[model samples]
Target: MSTLEPIQVGLSNALLAPERPLPPGVITWNGSDPSVRFDVYRNNVVVSLTTALAEGFPVTRALVGERFFAAMARCFIADHLPSSPILSDYGDALPDFIAAFPPAQGLSYLPDLARLERARVQAYHAADAPALTAQDLACQLANPQRLSAARLALHPACIVLVSEHAIVSLWAAHQGQGRIEDVDLRRAESALVLRDGDAVLVLPLSLEIGHFLVALAAGAPLGEAAEIAAAAGPDVDLTQAIVLLIHYGGIAAWHTPGDL
Candidate 1:
């Protein structure tokens, strides 16, 4: 190993684990203890990163309370260090981490809640694309035959998530739209996430609509996606879902199979 490698390792370890002594050769003033200086820097980094996480997952913090959330953040930061320079993109693995976290086992809905929050963050950072308007889609699908083979592209910011918990209701409650006491915990919920103008919108989705959107996002043709939605449950309203998708600016583009 190179001489610098050991120093790098030492610095990294010192930052992640405060109990470790400072690595040798870190220059310090004659009166200052190297360990103390390193501890100061280490605490600062952790605090900054933790604050970023709190900003990204405010609902999660609210659910777990401040003290518990801080402890959880500390453990997560140590296990999963940021790989990218963008602080906003940090905590991508938090949902999975929460899923497997021993202390959070009782809260099965916590992981899905985290996933919903992460999706919002991702939607906020997603690239912009021109939304397909109802008129535009209608013009393209003038022929029923052509409509069957049409493949629709979702907006870059669109995401569909199906959850066993009433995550959408929970999220909405915490956002001040409703009282948490009224949420039906026994009900399952799905979510459709997309950006509307400058803000990210999270809407509750029916199972059929959720399946249909997911299939379309995966490049399925219109007819096939409709079939998928119908298979999900009885009286699946594909038309209503399509209308809502257009209203939400979820569809970015569309082309018949022949166009490809």
Candidate 2:
């Protein structure tokens, strides 16, 4: 196989990058003014890509007016080409791009907000797992010391996010314009995103809970994560966070680390 064939194949399928013209023998259309025919395809290509981008970053579009949104979309398309056929996965680089975009500078938390949105979408597709309930925990918590060293299992859809700005407010505000008058944008926040059955929920997390989840995600034992959470923030309530984790999908089950 020649290198040019693979290049042609890639260009044909890639929706986000510039369309490379095919070799002379690759097409059936023969016309003196071929550019006109090609223009139709080019327009379709641009529309398809722009539409996907707009769907992915509607918040970004809302923040930056429509004209600038199209311009930024063009830049984003040129810089990072689509690596997959799935349009939903197209804008993973958008948050990073927004951080560097000059006009978007005023929205300092835009990147984190984008991250939160992406996590919500990804969490929606995460594999399903049976969640632990209070009844299940009542039986499992019987061996209190054993539970400490055991590896805690987080649900497949559980995700934790940490932000330095009020991204949670940004996300909630975008949910509707009603509470827009009451929200103060200066507050800092963090959140946990998880799936319960078919619904995806983004619940607010206290700073201690966020740190505890991060520690658990880092493979810290339950006892160690609680300790780390305490060391970082003295007010951390292990019992409460643990209960919520089990309640929300942050935790699915407990197991002795080496048990077969």
Candidate 3:
């Protein structure tokens, strides 16, 4: 037998608005003002979900002011309910929602910026691992026979984003109090967000580099992944990409996952 989602639509609707009437004889009161008690639940839902959206899309929040951020967040929350029990996963669909939102029609790039932010939070919570060291790769290369069966792993906190807008430039510019410059919407860009040591760095990736990382991240072996990257951009400089990944802790180490 199939299971139904336990989070009922009525509870969701009630939590979103205190004024929404509940099922009969199910008054929410514990001797306190019933209205205030219900307000607590309603307030918690809005605040918690709104905060999640804000944290997931700081750039988007910054692009529009606080009032509009709240409005957009409320709209998002109404149309989408969190599927995961974990609060961190609450805003996963927000980027796509923003892209389709009619009011944000003029800001086509907003969704991509939200994408960057969402990836950032996920990277922050990714599993920790000791990224591959320079000496490790060098030693592995010393033994040519190890090539065919060797494997590589991506770091737990690595996230790669490929977008056609200058999202990184736009994100960096407005993160601080400076005169934000006008950007050409026609520009293309990509970025790699990863946690290195104590800091999360959002590094802009060259088109070829981004494509290469995307393939490796999808489980392609290094040699073939390098070929795809090179084919895309002849001057990809695979060594440089590896250096960046190692330096930023985006890749752990290579290993055959199921090999005995």
The total of clashing pairs for model 1 equals 0
Model 1 lDDT per residue over 149-199, tens place: 889889999989988898999999999988999988667888899888889
Poorly placed runs, candidate 1 (over 4 Å): 1-4
Please give, for residues 144-211, the per-residue lDDT of candidate 3 as tens digits.
Answer: 66564555677879888878888888888877633467665567788999996677788988878888
List of clashing residue pairs for candidate 2: none
Candidate 3: stretches off by over 4 Å: 1-13, 17-19, 26-40, 143-151, 177-179, 255-260
Q: Count the backbone clashes (under 3 Å) in each candidate.
A: 0, 0, 2
* For model 3, the run of ten residues with the poorest summed lDDT: 1-10
RMSD each, Å? 1.9, 3.4, 4.4
TM-score, one value per model: 0.93, 0.81, 0.82
* lDDT winner: 1
TM-score of 3: 0.82
lDDT of each: 0.89, 0.75, 0.78
